[model samples]
Target chain A: MKELYNLGLSEIDIKNIIETYPEIKDLTDEEIAKNIEILKNINCNDKHIRNILIANPYYLNRSINDIKSLIMKLKEINIVNINLLFDSNPFLLNRDSYEIDEYIKKELEEGKKLEIIVDELESNPYIIDEK
Target chain B: MIVDELKRYMLEYGFNNEDINKILAVYTFKENEILFFNIKKINTLLETLGYTQNDIVKMAKRFPLLYSYSMKNIKQKIKDMQKLGYSYNDVIKIIKQLPAIYGYSIEENIKQKIKDMLELGYSYNDIIKMTKQLPSIYSYSIENIKQKIELYRLMNISHILVEKATYLMQSCELSFARYMFYKNKGIIIDENNYPKLFIDQLKFKRLYGIDNKTLIQMYNYDEYFSKEKNVLIKI
Candidate 1:
C-alpha cells in the first residue's frame, strides 16, 4: 500500500479527490486506484478524470448496484434521440452520473407523460435510477 | 545716459526737429531712426501723430516744452518708439510713470513694439533674435528669453523632449544646454543669448530617465558615435 502510495498517487491526491467528490470519501485506496486505472485505460487525462469523478458520484464511490440499476432503467426507456435529452438536460451530455429526481419532478410539473420523461432521462448519460 | 543729457541739451539750445534728430542719430546705433532721418520721413511721423512740420520745428526750438509733452504723449504721439531704439524696459517704465503719455499700458505698449518690429520686415525668428539681444527692451532676462524660445521651439520638436528641456532650463541646470545640442539639430540661441532647445532637451532627459551627468557626458563625447556610449543607465 505504501509502495502504491509512492507511485505519484499520494495521500494528499486521494484526500483532494475525495473532498471534491464527497460520494467517493468512503472508497479504499485500492478502489480509487482501480477506478483511476480504468479511466487511464480509456485514455482519460487528469482533467478528464477529475471532471468524470465530479460528474459521476456513483462511479467515484464504486457503486456497482447503482450502475446496474441505471443501465436497466435506460434499457426499459428505449430512448431513440440523444439530442432531445441533451436539450432537456445539457449537464447529462458530458457526465455519466447525476441525480435525476429534480428532472423527474420538473417533468411531472410540466405534465409530461411518464414514458416520455423516462425516454428523455434514458437518453441522458448522467441520469441514473436510485433502485 | 548720454542720450538723455543730449535730449536736455537739445531743449536748452532750441535745436529744431532736424538738429535734435540728427544728434539722436549720432548717439543711437539703431539703423531705423537713421533711415527715417535720411528719408525726411519725420514729417510723416509728425503728421500721423497730428503734429505739423511747423509744430515739430517749434517743439524742437522749445526743447523743455517738447520733451515734457513728448514724455506725456509718448504712446499716442510716437508710432515707432522702437525705431527710436527705446529699450522694452525703458518703454515700459515710461508707460507706467506717464500713463497719460501713452494710450496703452506697458504690456500693450510692449506688444505694439513687438507688432511694429514684426511689421518692419522682421521674421518671428528675427524679432525673437532682437528680443533676446535687447531683453531690457521687453524687461526680460536671459532666462525669460530662453523660456520663450523653448515655448516657440516646442511647435517643431517632440513634446517629450520639449518638456524635458523646459524643466532643465527653468531649474537653471547647465546640463539642459548640452542636451539641447544633442536632442535635435542645435537650435540657434536667439540674439537674447537664450538657448532655443533648452526646454525640450531638459524635458526629454527628465522623462526618459536620463540623468544630468549622463547627458553632460553624452554632450562631451561629440566625436564619439557609439550606441553604448549614448545609452543612459540609472545608477
Candidate 2:
C-alpha cells in the first residue's frame, strides 16, 4: 500500500481498487511491487501504471512469466504501443496468451487485415473479450 | 513549513492525499512566495462571490489548478464570461462546472472557439446552449469540435442531439467505427434513434438481438464488409 502511495496513488484510489477486487488484499505487497516493476520495464509511466492497476488489480495475482509471455504475444503481432494497450485495457494482459492469439487469428481468418485488428483492439479492446 | 500548512488546509477542506499531491505537483510557485496566503485569498474571493467553502472545495477537486490562478486572473475570467452575456449566476455555474476555464485565454481560446463555431453554422444561442451543458467545449480546439460535428452530420445525426448530449463530442474514432457498424447493420441513427449508436455493451446485445462477439466482428470488419458490398454490387 505504501508502495502504491509512493507511486502517487491516493488512499481513495487504493481503497477503490481493493473494493473492486478483494482478492488483491491477499497478494503480498512484494508481489504487487513486482507487477508494478514489470509495467515500468515496458516504459509505462506512473500515470499509465496507476491506470492499469486501477482498471484491473488482477495483474498483481498473475505470475511474472504469465505477464511476460502475454506481452511477447502482443509484440509478436506488431503491437508497438504496448503502454497504451495495457493502460487502455489492463484486462488484456490477464487473459491467457492462447485466448488472445485465437481471437486475433479468428479476426485475421475473417479477411480483416492484421493492422485493423490491432487498431480496433487498441481502441475498443473489449472486442477481444470472451463475453 | 508552508507546504505542510497548505497540505493541512487542503486536508481540512476535504482534499484527499492524492488531491493534495496533484496540487503540489502541478502548482509551481516561487520559493519566497507565501503559498498558503494565496490559497486563502482565492478561497475568500470565491466566498465573496457567493460560493460556499464546500463549493470551492468541489471546484478545486475537479480542477486542481484552481489553486494556481492569481486572484486577479480569476476575477477577470469571471468578468469575461459575463461580458459574453452570461448572467452573474450563469458565470458562477460555468466556473462551478469547469474551473479549468480559468486556464483558457479570452482572445486566444474562448472567443476564437466561439467564432469558429459560429463560422461553422452554429448560431450564438447554439454555442451558448452547448457550452452551458458541457463547459469543456471552450477547451476543445475548433478542429476537434469541427471533426465531431462533421462526423455526426455525416451519420445523419441531428445538430440538436449534439447540443443535448454534449458527451457525444468525445471519442471521434470510436464514434466513427460505431457509425460504420450501424450503417452495415442497417441501424438508422438520427436525432430520435441515435442512442443505438452508443450502447456498445450488453444493452447492445439485448437491443440488437446480436451477441457481443458478433458486434465486435461487425465493428472490426467494417472495412471488409464495405468491400464485400462493393464486390457484390459489381457482380
Interface C-alpha RMSD after superposing true interface residues, each candidate, one decimal: 45.7, 13.7
Best by lDDT: 2
Residue B67's lDDT in candidate 2? 70
* Top candidate by TM-score: 2
For B105-203, candidate 1 gives per-residue lDDT tens digits of 333445644665455344555554454433322322222234334443433332232223222212212234343554455444443434433333335
C-alpha RMSD (angstroms) for model 2: 15.5
Docking class of 1: incorrect
RMSD of each predicted structure: 43.5, 15.5
lDDT for position A58 in model 2: 49
Candidate lDDT values, in order: 0.39, 0.66
Query: Which CAPRI tier for candidate 2?
Result: incorrect
Error of 2 at A129 (Å): 29
Q: Which regions in candidate 2 have their CA more than 4 angstroms from the true location? A: A1-131, B208-235
